[model samples]
Target chain A: MELLGYLGEGFATSLMPINILIVMIGVTAGLFIGAMPGLGSVNGVAIVLPITFIVPPSSAIILLCAIYYGAMYGGAISSILLGIPGASTAVATTFDGRPMAQQGKAGLALIAAAAASFVGGTISVVLFTLFAVPLADVALAFGPAEEFALVLLAFTTFVGLGGDDVLKTIIMICLGLVLSAVGLDLISGDPRLIFFDQPGFYSGISFLVLAIGIYGVGEILYTIETQKSAPQVTPAKITFRELWYGLKEINKLWKTMSFGSFLGFFVGMLPAAGATPAALMSYGIAKLLSKKPETFGKGAIEGVAAPETANNAASTGSLLPMLTLGIPGSPTTALLLGGMVMWGLVPGPMLFIEQPDFVWGLISSLYTANLFAVLVNLALIPLFVWALRMPFTVLCSLVFVLCLVGGFAPSQKLHDVWLIVGFGVVGYVLRKADYPMAPLVLALVLGPLMERSFRQTLIAEQGNMMAFVERPISGTFMAIAALFFVLPMLKHVKRLLRRDLSPAE
Target chain B: MITGARGKLRACLGGKVETIMLTADRVLAAGIMVLSVYFMWHASALPIGWNGMTGGPGGGAFPFWLSGIMFLCAGGIVLRSFKDSAPFAKDDTPFFDPDTLRSVVVVTLALTATVAALPFAGAYIAIPMFLLWYLKIYGKHGWVLTGALTICTPVFLFFFFEVTLKILLPKGWTEPWFFPLYARFF
Candidate 1:
C-alpha cells in the first residue's frame, strides 16, 4: 500500500508537461546518438550534460535517464541494418542482425530488438522498484571496507573479462586509470600531472573528453582505416507479415528472453556492471546453452534476442545502484548521478526517505520511457534504414561534424577537440591491435571511484589491507575476487595439462 | 625461387601486402608499449602527497599505478610479437588497399589540422573554414550544401553552447572584432 502511494505520487510528478517534454527530447536525442556508430549511450549522455546545468535537477535527470534508455534502443538499428555496431553491447546483436538484414528482414530484426528491449526494460524497472529500496538498506549497512572491496571487484571483473587477450585489456584499463588521475585528488586536493597548470587540468580529465576520445574519435578512425571498397548495404523492406513473423520468432525464443533479462538484471545490480557486458555475457551464455551453438555466428534469432534483452535490462538495472548508493554503475548512470547532485538530491540511503516524490517520479518516468521507446523505434526503424542509404561520403562527413560539435559542446573549449582526436588515434590503434576498447573505456569511467574507495579503505584501516578480509561483506567480495582470479588460472592449467596428454589418452 | 625484377617488385609491394600491414601493426604496437613505459615513468615522477588528517593520496598515484600495469602488459605484447613469426591478419582481406589508405589518411589529417587550429582561430572562424574545405574539396559537395553547412555550423554552436548553456568559448582576436555582433545577439 505504501509502495502504491509512492508510485502514485511518482506518476503525478512525471505527468508534468515539462518532465514529459524533457523525457521526449532525451529519448529523441539518445536514439539519434545511439544509432550512430561510435556514439554510445555514455557519449550521448556526456555530450548533453552541460544542458542539464541550466535545467531543473528533476528535469535534467529525467532527460538524461530517458536518453540512456533511448540510446540502448537506438544501438540495435546499425547492428541490424549496417552490420556496424553503434555500441560494444550491440556487437553481439550484429552477429544475427546483419545476417537477418541480408535476408531482407532488417525491419523485422529491428522490430524484434525494439520489442525485446521494451520487454526487458519494463521487467528490470519493476525489479528495480521492488528491490532498490531494500538493496539501499542493505548497502547502507556496509562499511568503507565493503565499499572498497566492491570497487575492487568491479575493477578486476572489468579488466579480466572480455577480449581475445586479457593482457591487452588490462593494459588499456591501466591506461584509462592513469588518464583519470590527471587532475586534483578528490580527498587531498593536490594537483597532479597538471603540466599546463590550468584550472581545466586541475579538475582532471573530463568524462566528456575520455568518452569522445575513445568512442567518437576512435570510431571515426576505425571507419577511416577500414574503408569498405563498396558500401555494404542492402535495401530491405519488411511487410506486416514479416513483422508478425519476427514477433513470433521472439515469442518462440521465450527462454532466451527470460535468460537475457535475468542475466542483465543480476549484472546490472552489480556496481560498475554496465549494459555492454551484460549483453555480451548473456549472448555468450545463450551460445553456450544452445544446442546448435554453431548457429550463433550465423543469424540465429536467439543471438539477437539475448543481447537486445540483456542490454535493455542492464540499462534499467544500472539505475538501482545509482539511485541507492550515489554510485554510478556506468557512464550513463554517472551523467545522471551528476544531474542528481546538481539538483541537490544526492543519491544515497536518504534519497528515498527525503525525496520520495523525486525518486518515484524518476522511477515512474522510466516505465513511460520504455513504452515510448517501443513506439518510437517501431515508427523510426524504416526511416533509419533510409538514412543508411545516404551516400557514404556524405554520411561520414555529417557524422564527423556531429562528433566535432558534440565533443566541443560540453566545455565549449578547443582543448576537448584535440583530446578527442588524440583519443581517436589511440582508439584506432587499440582496435587495430585487437585490444577490447570496452575495458579501457569502462576503466576510465570507474577509475576515480576505485582509487577513492581504495584510499578510503586504507585510511580507515591505517594502511592495513586486512580490513577488507575482516568485515563479512568485504570478505565475501574479496573472496569472489580471489575466486575470479584463481578459477581462470586453474582452467588454463587444466587445458595445458590436457593438451600435454596424447590422443590415445 | 628466382624471380624477375618486376615480379620481385610485385611480390614485395602487392603479394606481400598482408605481411607488410601485419608487420607494421606489430611495430606500432611495440612502439606504443615503449611509449606507455615512458608515460608510466613520467606519471610516477609527479609530485603526489596526502594532506593532514590521513587524506587520500593525490591524483598522480592512480595514474602511476596504471602506467606501471600498462608497461607490464606492453612487455607481454612484445613477447607475443617475438613468438608469432608469421603475419596475422584480423580478417582474410588485404589490410590496406592504396585508395582506402589515401582517403582515410587525408580525412584524418584534415580533421586533426582543423582541431589543432581551433585554439588559435576562434571556433566561428575555424569551424566554417574547415567545413567548407572538407565539403568542397574532399566531399565534392555543391556550393549550396557547403555554404549552408558552413554558415549554420557556427550559428548552431554559438546558440547551443554560448546562449543556451552559458559556457564561454575562446573568442580569440576575432572576439574583439565581432564583440558588437555577439553582444547584440546575446
Candidate 2:
C-alpha cells in the first residue's frame, strides 16, 4: 500500500505537461541519434548533457533517462534495416534481424523488435522499482570503509570479467586515477600534479571533458576509418496487418522474453557485463532452447525478439546501482552519475531519504519513457529510413561542431577544449590499439570517491589498516574484490594445466 | 638447417616482420611508461607516504603508487609484445589503410583548426567555416544543402545557448557584434 502510494505520487509528477513534453522530445532526439551507425546512447547523452541545463535538475534527469531508453529501442532499427548495429548493445540484433530483413520481412522484424523492447523495458522497470528501496536501505549502512571496498570491487570486475586485454585495462585505470588526483588534494587542501604550471590544472579534469572527447570526438574519428562506404538501408513499410501478426508471433515467445528479461536484469547490474553481453547471452540461450534452433541467424523471428528484449532490459538494469548505491553499472550510467553530481542531486542512499519526490519522479518517468520510446520507434520507421540515407559526413560535421561547442559550454574554458582535442586524438589511437575506454571513464568518475573514503576510514581508525576488514560489510566487499582480481589469473592457470595434459594425452 | 630453425623460431614468435600494429603497440606501451614516470615525479612533490598526523596515506600517496603500478603494467605489455607468443606477433594487420588514413587526417586537422579559431575568430565565424569545408568541399554535397546548414546551425546555436540557456559562447573578436543581440535578449 505504501509502495502503491509512492508510485501514484510518482505518476502525478511524471504526467505533468512539461515533463511529458520533455520526454517526447528527448525520445525523438535519442531515436535519431541511436539510428545513426556510429553514435549510441553515451554519445547522445554526452553531447546533449550540456544543453540540458535550461530545465530544472529533476526534469533534466528525466529527459536524459528518456534519451537512454529511446536509444536502446532505436539501436535495433539500423540493425534490422541497414544490417548495421546502431550501438554495441544492438550487435546481437544484427545476427537474425539482417536475415529477416533480407527475406523481405523488414516490417515484421521491426515490429517484433519494438514489441520485444517494450516487453523487456516494462518487465525490467518493475524489477527496478521493487529492488530500488531494498538496495538503498542496505546501502544506507555503508561507511567510508564499505565505500572504498565497493569502488575497488567495481574496478576489479572490469579486469576480471572484461574481454579487453588485462594489461591495457590496468594501465587505463591507473591513468584515470592519476588524472583525477591532479587538482587540489582532498585531505590536505594543497595543490598537486600542476603540470607545466597550467592554471587549468588547479580545477582538475571533469568527467564531461573525457566523455565528450572519447565518445564524441574520438568516436567520430574512429568511425571515419571504419565506415568508409555507405550501407544500404532496407526500406521498411509497416502495415497494421503485419503489426498485428508480429504481436501474435511475439506473444507466443513469452518464455524467451521473460527469461531474457531476468537474465539481462541480473547481468546488467554487474559493472563488467552490461547490455552487449546480456543480449548476446540471451540470444544464444534462446537458440539453444528452441526446437528449430537451425533457423536462428537465418530469419527466425525469435532471434530478433530475444536480443531486442534483453538489451532494453539490461539498460534499465544498469540504472539500479547508480541510483541506489552511487555506483554506476555501465559507462552511460557513469555519465548520468556525473551529471547528477553536477546538478547537486548527489545520487546515493541519502538521495532517497532527502529527495523522495525526485527519486520517484525519475522512476515513474522511466515507465512513461519506455512507452513513448516504443510508440516513437514504431511510428518513426519511415522517417529513420529516410534519415539514415543522409550522408555520414554531414552527421560527422555536425557532431564535431557540437563537440566543440559542448566542450566549451560547460567550463567556458579554451583550455578544456584543447584537452578534449588532445584526449580525442589519443583516445582514438588507443582504441585502434585495442585499449578499452570504459574502465578509464569509470575510474575518472569514481576516483575522488575512492580516495576520499579510503583516507576518511584511516583518519577515523587512527591509521588502523585492518579496520576495513574488521567491518563485516566492507570485509565481504574486499573479499569479493580479491576474488574478481584473481579470477583471470585462475583461468590462465587452468588453461596452462589443460595444455600440459593435452600434450601428454 | 640453421636457416630453417630461424624461420621456425620467427614463425613461433609473432615474427621478425614489422607490421604497423606491432610498431604501434610497442610505441604506445613505451609512451605509457614515460607518462607514468612523469606522473610519479610530480606526485613526489607532496608526501607520497604515510602522514602520521593525518593517520593515513598522504595526498600524493594515491597518485604516486597508482602511477608506479601503471608503469609496471605498461612494462609488462612491452615485454609481452617481444615474446614469440605475444598476441599481435602472430597476426599482423596495418594500423590504418592509406586512403582512410588520409581522410581521417584531413578531418582531424579541420576539427583542430576550428577549435583553435574559436576563441580568436569567435564561434559564429569559425563554426560555419568548418561546416562549409566539411559539407561543401570535402563531402561534395549540393551547394543548397551546404549553404542551408551553414546558415541555420549558428542561428539555432545562438538562440539555444545564448538566448535560452544564457550561457554565452566565446565570441572573441565578434563580441562587439553580439552586443545588439544581447541588448535585446537581456
Candidate 3:
C-alpha cells in the first residue's frame, strides 16, 4: 500500500544516525524536564526549541516530538513518587500512583506508569498513521465558513464539556477571546484595541507568553500556597522481574486500559478537549465500570494505569488536528506548530501532500520515541525516584527561576516577564476561586484563528450571516454547536419544571 | 446557614472586624465586569462592522462582537458570584490570614522588583538578588544554602542558555561585565 511505502521511507529518515541520537537526547531531556515540578511538555519544548533551530525541519520536528512524548510519559513519575503532577495531564495519576508509592509498591507503580504510557502512545500512533492523511484530505475541502463553524464548535465543547462552572467558564473564555482581540487586525493593518499607541500593542499577546505565565509561574505560586513536603522517599529500583510483574498485573486491567486509550485518543483529537479532561474522564469511567469502585484513589493499579495511559494517548492524539488541519489541539502542539513554522514548514492540509517526508518522519519517529521512552523509563526508574528526593523549598524556588528564564527566552523582552508575573497572580487567583484555566487558554490560542476565519467567511459571503449554517459541512458543525448551547439550557429548564411539578416532601 | 457561606465579609484592619462588604467572588466578578465594559467601549471606537470596501470587515468587527460577548458574560458572572459558595467564593472566609498576607505581599513585591530590575541590573544580578532575598530573607534558610544557590544559579544559566544554546540574554549596564564571558562563550 502507499501507506506502507511512505512509512518505509519515514523509517529510513528516522533511523538515520543523527536523527536517532537526537531522539535519544530529546527523550532523556524531556524526562528530566517533566520530572521537575511545574515543568510540563509546553515548558520543555519552549525551553529547548532554540537548540533545534540548527537542525533540518524533519530532525527539528523529530526532536521536539520526542521531547513531547518523553515529557508526557515523564509526567507520571512525579505523580507516582512525589504526589505532585509535573504536568496538568498527570494530575489524575497522583490519586492512585502516590497511594501506591505510599504503600511501598513504588517500583510497581513506576513500571505500571511506563508500560501504560507506552501502550497508549503506541496505539494512538497507529491510529494517527492510518487516519491522518484521510482526515487532512477531508479538511482540505473546507472553506472559511466551514472552518469558522468548526472552530465555534470547538469553543462550545471546550466550555460546555470541559469545565464545572458554566458561567465562570464562559466568562473566562470570553475574556481570553477579547484579550486576543487587542491588537491590529490580520487583514486590515488598523489597530483594534491598542491602549497607548505602544509598538508592542501592534503584535498580539503571544501564546508562549500566556502559557509560561499561566502554567509555569502560576503553577509555582499555586504549589507554594498548598505546599506539602514530599513524603520520605526510599530509592525503589525497577528490575526486569518487577517490570514484568507490573505489566502482568496491568494485563488483567485491559478493559480500563482500552477505555483510557480510546477515550484519550478521541478527546485528544478534539481541539478543545485535551489530556487533563481525558485523564479525568477515563478515571471517572473506570471507577463507574469497576466492580470495586471504592478501590479507585486507594492505590488501584487500574487507577494508576488508566490516567497514565490516557494523558499520553491524549497528548499524541492532539497532534492529529495540527498535522492535518493546522489547528493545534493542545498548547504543546501549538508550540510545536510554532517550531514547524520556524523551520519554514506550514502545518495544514497541504503539509501532508507537499512535505511528506517531515510529516511521515515525525509520525514514524513517534513510534520509535514511544518505544525508547518505555525502555528509558524502565531502565532509569531508580534515577527518576531520586528526583523525588528533592526538598519542596528547593523545588519551589528552582521552578520560579525556570519560569523566569523560560518566560524571557522566546522574546528576550522584559514585557514577557511582567506578563508572566501578572498572569501568574491572575492564574493563582483564578485557581483559588475554582475557575478553570483550560477554557481560557484554549480560547486565547484559538481566538485569533477564529477571528480571521470569521472575518474571511463574512467577506467571502459578502456579509451574509446565514452562510455559516448554509454550507453542508459548516451547517452540520453549526447545528452541533447550537446543540451544545441548547442541551444545557434544556437540562436547566427540565430541572426547573420538575421542581415546579413535584409536591413538597 | 452556618456552613460559612452566607455571611458578611468583614475586614479586619488590625484584629477588629470592620464594616461588612461584598464576597470575594462578587468583588472579583464586579471588577472583571468593569474591565469588560472598558474593553468593549474601546473596541466599539473602530468601525463596528463591514467597511463596504472589497467585502472586507472593519478592523474592529471581530473584536467588537467578542467584546460584546465578554461584556454579557461578565454581567452573568457578577450576578452568579453573589449566589456561589465554593471555597474561594465565600463571604466570610478571610482572603488571607495575617501571616499569609505578609508572605504574599513580600513574595509579590520581590518578584515585581526582580522583573523591574531585569533591564537595569540584568538577569545575572537581578536573579541572584531575588533568590538571595527569597531564600534567605523570606525562606529563612541557612546562609550556606542561600549563598551557594545565589552564586551557582547565574553560572548555570550562563553556561546553559549562553554557552550552549546561543541565546543572547539581556544584559543591562553590566552588559560590559557579560562581554568578557560572552567573548569566552561566543
Best by TM-score: 2
Residues B6-122, model 3: lDDT tens digits: 342222334544212235566677777777777867787777767877576787767677667766765666555444333344345555444355666667788888888889788
Q: What are the lDDT scores of the predictions, listed in order?
A: 0.74, 0.92, 0.79
Per-candidate TM-scores read: 0.85, 0.97, 0.90
Docking class of 3: acceptable
Instruction: Write the candidate numbers in order of decreasing TM-score.
Output: 2, 3, 1
Residue clash pairs of candidate 3: none
Which ranges in model 2 have alpha carbons more than 4 Å from their true place? B1-15
| Cα lDDT, model 1, residue A333 | 75
Global local distance difference test of model 1? 0.74
* Error in Å for residue A487 of model 2: 0.6
- Model 3, span A378-436: residue lDDT tens: 88776777776766666667667777887777567777778889888888787666677
Number of the top-ranking candidate, with lDDT as the measure: 2
Tens-place lDDT digits, model 1, residues A157-198: 654444246676677767777777777666657666664455
Tens digits of per-residue lDDT for model 2 on A1-505? 7877888899999999999999999999988988899788989998888889999999999999999988898899999999999999999999999999999999999999999999999999999999999999999999999999999999999989987888999999898889889899998889999999999989999999999999999999999999879999999999899999999999999999999999999889998889999999999999999999999989999999999889999999999999999999999999999999999999999999999999999999999999999999999899999999999989999998889889888888988998898899999999999999999989999999999999999999988999999999999999999998888899989998989889664
